[model samples]
Target: MNLSIDVTNNEGVSNVVLTGEVDAFTAPKLKDTLLPLTKEKGQVVEVDFQDVNYMDSTGLGVFISALKSTKEHASTMRLVHMQDRVYRLFKITGLTEIINIESTVQGGM
Candidate 1:
């Protein structure tokens, strides 16, 4: 799986834009990239999936693990711009309620 990550730091928030497939082979990579960003004090991490084309359970696991790690470090993590299929996956897995998923970057409101 091919994965690309672009991280933007803004006002204590880390916007991570993810593109490409996130599967077992690539989930760890995503985790590694997100873990450190979420460890910073007062850091709010947002994983943007607007460009993602595919994902699997491992991808969901990556998000869950990131959320757990972020909470441990007193940081926040959220999902943004998920495609319809990705959103359905979250809904089917009941992760939509467990994680912070926004339709847009503006708090999904």
Candidate 2:
């Protein structure tokens, strides 16, 4: 299925809710939605992956680029509520070591 992204801003944080598969086809859409947020200094961009069932290497690359962009802007990017399969992808790729991931909503909120 195609990917869907929902974005909401709360205070200074941007909450991005992602659903469906994130592959090469949909990864660009994710980047377009997120890359701009990373340009806003002091902005906190939170990606909630609770509904995302699949993500490929392309999607992972998008997140890595966003992480770099956010850091350059002195902002932060958080990955939240990742499914077990998706989380394992990050773990295996060693992205978990570089990216900020919050398993609990409390930490994200």
Best prediction by lDDT = 2
Q: In order, how many clashes per candidate?
A: 0, 0
Supply the global lDDT for candidate 2: 0.91
Model 1 lDDT per residue over 1-109, tens place: 5999999999999999998988888889898898898888779998899998789998998888888888889999989898777788888999889899975344455
Worst 10 residues of 2 by lDDT: 100-109
Error of 1 at 51 (Å): 0.5
Structural similarity to truth (TM-score) of each candidate: 0.88, 0.92
For every candidate in turn, the CA RMSD to the true structure comes to: 3.5, 3.6
Superposed model 1: Cα runs more than 4 Å off: 104-109
Angstrom error of the Cα, residue 68, model 1: value is 0.7
Q: Per-residue lDDT of 1-109 in model 2, one digit per residue for the tens?
A: 6999999998889999998999999999999999999899999999999999899999999999999998899999999998878888899999899999965444445
After TM-score superposition, the amount by which residue 81's alpha carbon in candidate 1 deviates from its true location, in angstroms, is 0.5
